[model samples]
Target: MSGFESNPFADPVDVNPFQDASITQATSGATENVGEFNPFAGTNSGKTIPISAASSQPAVLQTSMEQSAQENAAAGQASLIKQQEELERKAADLERREQELQTGMENNWPPLPSFSPVKPCFYQDFEEDIPEEYHRICKRMYYLWMCIATLFLNVLACLAYFTADSASGVDFGLAILWFVLFTPVSFICWYRPVYKAFRSDSSFSFFFFFFVFFFQVAVYVIQTVGIPRWGNSGWIAAISMIRVNLAVAVVMMVVAGFFTVNAILSVILLKMVHSKYRRTGASFTKAQQEFSSGVLTNRTVQTAATSAASAAAQGAFGRNQEN
Candidate 1:
C-alpha cells in the first residue's frame, strides 16, 4: 500500500498541444533551424556542399521541371511547322486542279447535222476545184441516175396499182409522187447551187446543197417502198414471181442509191472546199469587193511581197491576176 501510494504521488510531465515544439526540442532542432532562418536557404553558401543527395532533391526536381517546359515548347513548334507544311500541300493541289479545268477538256463531239453552212459539216462542195470537163461529166451522170430512178419508180408504181397482193402493193402512190417531186428537185438542187458558184463565186454553196437535198430525201423514202411491189417489166405478173419484181426493185434501188450518194458526195466536197477557203487569204466576198473597188484592176498579184499580199487579200484590197 505504501509503495503504490508513493508511485501515484510521483506524476510525469503533462504535454500541451499548443506548446512551441522548437523551444522544447531546441537542442535537437537548432542545426536545422539555422538553415531555415537563412534568407538564401535553397542555395549553397560560398564553396559549401550538400551533406546528402536528399537535401538537393528539391533543386533537382526544379531543374527537371524547367527541362520538361523547354522540351514541350520545342515539340509545340515542331507540330506547328508540320501543320503549316500540310496546309501548303493542300493549297498546291487545289491550284493544280484549277489550272486543269481552265482548258476545255471534256471528251465529246460537236452536235451533228447542223444546217448552217458557216459551220463545217460532213457534206461539202468542191465542184469548183474539179476540172470543168470532169464536173460536166459528173453532172451528166447525175442526170442519168435521176432519169433511171424516175423510170423504174414509175414502173414500180404501175405494178403496185395493178396487183392486189400486199407484196405487189408497195406504196405506188409514194413512188409516183417521189418521181414527180424529185426528178426536177435533183436538177434544182445542183443546178442553181452550181450556177451561184459560177456566177458569183459564193462561199456558201453548202447552205444551198443541204437546203435542196431536203427534196431529194423524199425520193429515198419512196424508192425504198416501191421495189417490193413493182413487177419486173409487165409480163408474167404474180405474187409467186416476187424474185423478178425484187430484181427490178433492186435495179431501181441501185439507181436511187447512186443519186443519193452523188448528192451526199457533192455536199462533202463542197465542205472541203469551204474549209480551204477559210485558210486562204482571199474569200469570195473580199475578191468581189476588190474587183468592184478597182484595187485589182490590171494589177498583177505577183508584184508585191507575200505578207503585204496576204494582208491585202484578206481584206477588200487585193491585187488580182491579169489574164
Candidate 2:
C-alpha cells in the first residue's frame, strides 16, 4: 500500500500543509488582486447610484432627523403664538389708555372759556338775529325799550322846566315816581304780554295784550299832551315855554319829540299788532285754553302745590300732637 492510502485507524503522520504549491499560488494571487484595486479610479464615470443608497443613512438617524424637524416646527409655531399674544396685550393696553384719556377730557367741570370774554348786548344785524316771522314784533319791542330808556331824558327836561319856572317839589316827585312805576309796569304788563302773545300766536294773550296796550297807548297820548305837573312836556307846554325862554323851549321841544316818537310808535305798532292778530286767527277762547294748559304744567305751580301739601301735612301733625 502507498502512504497516501493509510487507513483511518492508523496513527496520523505530521506533515506541513504549506508545502502545497497550488494553495500558496492561489493565496499570493488573491493578495496581488487586492493590492491592485483602487476605489478613486475614474473609469466608472456615467454610473449613477440611487440617492438613498449613496447616502448610506441609517433608518434610526432618518427618523430622528424627522422628529427634530417636527420639534423645530412646533417651537416656531409656539413662538408665533407668543408674539401674537404680546401684540394683543399691547393693543389692549393702548386702547385702555385712550379710553382713560377720553373720560378725563369729558368730565371737565366749570366749562372752558368762551371765544370772546365779553358778550354782545345788541345784535349787529337785527334781521339776522331776529327770526323772520318775529322781526317786526321784536323791532317794536326794541323800540319800546328805547322809548323807556329815553324817558330819562324826559326827566331831565322836566327838571329843567321846573327849575326855569316855579317848579313844585310835589311835581318833581311825581315825575320820578311816574318814570319808576311806569317803565317796569309797562314792560311787565303790556310789552312782555304782547311779545309773548305774538310769539305764541295765542288769541287770548293777544286780546289781553291789546286791552292793556290800548290803555298804555292812551297813557302815552296823555303824556304827550304834557298836562301841567305831569312827567311830560305836552305840545302846549313846549310852545308856551318857547315864548317864555328859548333854552326852555328847546328842552321842551326835545322832550316833545321823545313823546311824539312814543305816541307814533305805539299807534303804528298797535295797527301792526291788530293786523297780526287778524292773520293769526287767535281768539280769546284759544288764549284761555293755552293759559289753562300753561298754568297746569308750570313748574312754579307744581312747586307751590308741593309746598302746600307739606305745610298741610305739618299742620295736621301739629293738631294730632295737640289732641
Top lDDT prediction, candidate number: 2
Worst 10 residues of 1 by lDDT: 231-240
lDDT of 2: 0.75
Candidate 2: tens digits of C-alpha lDDT, residues 179-269: 8888778867876676666555667678778889888889878878877766677676778787668897798788788888888888888
**Deviation (Å) of 110 in candidate 2:** 25
| Number of clashes found in candidate 2 | 3
TM-score of each: 0.31, 0.53
Predicted candidate 1 versus true structure: per-residue lDDT over 223-260, tens digit per residue:
43334434222222322345645655344444445445
Instruction: Give candidate 2 regions above 4 Å deviation.
Output: 1-134, 239-244, 309-323
TM-score (C-alpha) between model 1 and the true structure: 0.31
Question: Candidate 1, residue 211: CA error in Å?
Answer: 2.8
